[model samples]
Target: MSRPDILLYTANTMNGWKPLIFLHEAEIDYELVPVDLGRKEQKAPAYLKLNPNGRIPTIVDRGNGDFAVFESGAILWYLAEKYDRFLSHDPKERSETLQWLMLQMGGIGPMMGQAMFFQRIAKPNGDEVPYAINRYVAESRRLLEVLDTRLAGRDWLVGDAMSIADIATYPWARSYFWATVSVDGLPHLQRWFDRLDAMPRVQAALQLPEPRPSVFGEGDITAAAQENAARFKDQ
Candidate 1:
């Protein structure tokens, strides 16, 4: 079979990582094209045609005649179905797997990402900082706890194997590039996270150049981002 040319216009965010991790796990052949986020390149007119949402991780499936797939969770599932692996053979198990994926897409990802942004972006004055941080941190912790409970007796989310669900949720498991997760309290989640981390495919997918040290800008916004970066470090 002729391999599809996979054109991935993406940054190294969790959403982008999801698809690449899935591709590597499937051992599929494809091309990877980096979209320069540093230049606001995703907002260009050419990329707008591919994804009007102006997001990274937009994948073009060349084998499918250059059909495009947007949204990270959807793309992960598509890769699994296309590569014919890391998915359930039974219909019921497949449905459950998708359910978990949606939970991550709709719940964990959003809540955790908000926690990330608040921790690293929001200019909190007075009590806003602690309140916002506590709110989001508690919510994220609760969600992780739920996942831990659900994983009580299973090695994976669905069936007896890993699936697109794990790919969907792994990014948020360690947000902001291993920012502040303990991986200590949640034993089950830690185990699962380590299991995925140990995979050669996952490691290959994560094989990318570290972001170069650079200054963002020369003014106020730049200073704010730097401040957040500092506070993020303190956390």
Candidate 2:
């Protein structure tokens, strides 16, 4: 097989899956270069040059003079602009799409990540902090409520179609159960989640690199948390 023009440096985490899902939806040919977080490969000197933040989901666009892009949100924007798909050209609709994308970047992602850290990782490691857990979990739920409200009477986050906003947020939001947050009362959000969750592209994206174990299954949740803790231990 011929080499793809894009090389995605990623893991199986929620953030890592963002661009992967987009790539599938856009039907772009790409290569997946899995970064081994457990081995601290993301912090290696070479990887640092690509992503100074030392994070997953970085991309090297071979078709664009080998340009490198880091941060999940920025990567999504770059791909959307380059491919001229999944992002609208209409002024108002484009702005609305960006607004919802920013919500995921600045709000949902961080809040839910913190909630998962406190409830799953920290707690499992015997570093349980009740205040921290309560704070993040509550904030996560509030963000979900905001999404729930926005999703009411609508199928997508922006305009009348699925855009980068939905692509970026779905991975994080669908993992709500693992974060100890509930989506029980948010019917609209639940509907949206089910809609995206049932898509073949979304399902296929989750299996790339490898299939991640479900937290609800017999998987070792504590071990998973411990692995994640190592990523932020020095931060």
Candidate 3:
């Protein structure tokens, strides 16, 4: 069987960008089929056939001409399994790395999402939006502490080098500027992020598309996220 001809259908979503960031990091060759979420392209019947949720970041594995993968986390896991790199073969290390990957998928994604929701989308009527900010910011800080502990001595998520764990996190953790106002407290994680940023592969991935104007101050994604969420909820 030949290596599959692949089309990664994705928008510029954090989730969508996960696989692209990984593919670029791992130096995998594949075609990018930009799926415009703004045009309602993801909800199109043809696209829905690939992902029932009609989400971007779906991949068609043309080698079989039948297999397609959805879910950003699943896609990165699949790519690592297929490419046989960016992940460890050892059982313990592999499991550890996978744990971090899931942590980012489950922990960071939702917490930060709520941050975007209440802070930017809902048009909060207060100076602080204390409830929303405290909730997300606290959880985000907790998760970062977990990551920092894991990196207490190691340089990477896995035992030896950068792995799928890092790749999966590339889109979100790398957006630290958006997730939090300061990582100075997370010295280890901050260092880890800096190290990942310096890699040639990661550097190449960054060149693909700049992310959200750098997460410097608090963002205003709440309005957009709320609108999207309301639309999805209504549907």
Candidate 4:
């Protein structure tokens, strides 16, 4: 079979990492097109044609008539279905996997992203936004606790195997510091996080756009955040 030429347009954010995690795990051949969020490259006219939302982590399946997919979770689902891996063939297991994936999409990612914005970005702006900060932090923590409970007797989010559910959630949950929500007391979540972190594929995916770090340095982070704030102001 001829391998598809998949181009992933992404940055160094949680959502960006999710699809890469699945790609690496599935051993699918793909290319990385780094979108400079700090420079607002994602909002460019050409890029907007690929992802109308003007977001990173869009995938262009060039082998399939340049078919483009946007949104992190949706990208993972597409790849999983394409490769017949990560997601299960069993209907019950597949339903469970999708449910957990949605939890990350609707609850974990948004709440944690807001927490990071308020604590790391907005706080430094001197605006602080205490109400927003507290609300998201508390909510993120609550979500972490829920994950911990769900993971207590299980090794993976759904069934006995790792699936898109784990891939969808790990990136956000791993950055506990950024979200200002700790999983320290959630032993089960900690175990799950550590187990996934030890995987070589996960390590590789986390280091996308290598040799040039995706994470901002402390020295210029304030400026970086300010720039990002303007770019995502519509949110």
Worst 10 residues of 1 by lDDT: 209-218
The deviation in Å at residue 184 for candidate 1 is 4.1
For model 3, how does the per-residue alpha-carbon lDDT over 1-235 read when each residue is reduced to its tens digit?
4553677888655687777778876667788878765567889999999999988789988866668999888888888888897778889888888888898888877776666555543533334577778788777767767778888788987777888777777566656555553566778887898787677866665544433433433346655444455544422
Q: Find the candidate with the highest lDDT and give its number.
A: 2
For every candidate in turn, the CA RMSD to the true structure comes to: 5.9, 2.1, 4.2, 3.2
Model 3: how far residue 160 lies from native, Å: 0.8
lDDT of 1 at 23: 77
Q: Tell me the RMSD of model 1 versus the true structure.
A: 5.9
How many residue pairs collide in each prediction?
0, 0, 6, 0
- In candidate 2, residue 13 scores what lDDT? 86
What TM-score does candidate 2 reach?
0.93
What are the per-residue Cα lDDT tens digits for candidate 4 across 60-170? 898778899999999989988877988999999999999999999999999999898876666665667889988998999999999999999999999988999999999
C-alpha lDDT of candidate 2 relative to the true structure: 0.88
Error of 4 at 182 (Å): 1.9
Residue-by-residue lDDT tens digits, candidate 1, 56-117: 78889887889999899878777778778777879999899999999999988877777766
Measured on C-alpha atoms, candidate 3 has an lDDT of 0.71
lDDT measured at residue 88 in model 2 versus the true structure, 0 to 100: 97
**Superposing every Cα of model 4 onto the true structure, what RMSD results?**
3.2
Q: Clashes in model 4: which pairs?
A: none
